[model samples]
Target: MTTVTTPDAIVTAARGWIGTPYLHQASHRGIGADCLGLLRGIWRELYGAEPEPVPPYSRDWSEPSGDERLWAAAARHLLPGGAEAPGQVLLFRMRSGGVAKHLGVQGAVGRKPTFIHAYSGHGVVESPLSAPWRRRIVARFTFPEV
Candidate 1:
């Protein structure tokens, strides 16, 4: 894999995808991408290709599958970033009894933290990291070796 020489470069690359729509399984810029696709796009821009080809997945991919597969995969590739940090990847469990599936990028942290994510109808949005959203986070990741 190609190396990402700088952290700002990662942020810049992720920011470039701000307006893309949330189309499941796509990883193209200006066209469409879901939350994971946004990260896939960033990985491609930073490293020239995805570390591993993603398998076909459903919207409820891990929610009912009863496995923390996404979190596990992230653990293998991304450095753990503690609880709060700008530009960190945040994983969310959409329900109380479901597996962690949803993912987002923390854009700000402190009194008024915010995260960027692609919601089904909202597309890509930087949302306030409110208590409710905070409660669902299962893992946090920084780019590897950063």
Candidate 2:
């Protein structure tokens, strides 16, 4: 499988998005990007297109249905992470029992880990992979095949 696993390239691409406003259901490279849009933007940078057409999803992924659809979809397409390196996708569960809905790109690892993400109120910002955030991580994934 062709993969663009370069950490610098991924980090650089994500860094370019700093200050982009958060707009849900939108994925423009610089204009507006939500958390998923940030990842989708990087995917386009490395692979030219999103791996699959993201179906229209609510911020709540059908809470009444109680489905882990986003996680399941990530499992289907993106490369899963366990022994992960920099540039991998980090999926986070915002609350203890909430769905795994946040997406961040692993910017660095080892002592002082960091990740880049476009938060709802916080635009595109790079935050430390602090204990609180780390505790919320439900899954980690890497770029898809190029």
Model 1 quality (TM-score): 0.89
Error (Å) of candidate 2 at residue 122 is 1.1
Worst lDDT 10-window in candidate 2: 1-10
Model 2: per-residue Cα lDDT at residue 54: 86
* CA lDDT, every model vs. true structure: 0.80, 0.82
- On residues 11-128, what C-alpha lDDT tens digit does candidate 2 reach at each position? 8888888889888978886689999899888877777767799878888765668677878878887877767578888998887777788889988889999999998887898999
In model 2, the runs with Cα more than 4 Å from the true position are 1-3
Per-residue alpha-carbon lDDT of model 1 for 24-140, expressed as tens digits?
988787888898898888877766767887899888886665878888888887888875777788999888888888888887778998888877887777789999999999888
Question: What clash count goes with each model?
Answer: 0, 0
Per-residue lDDT for 128 in model 1?
Answer: 91
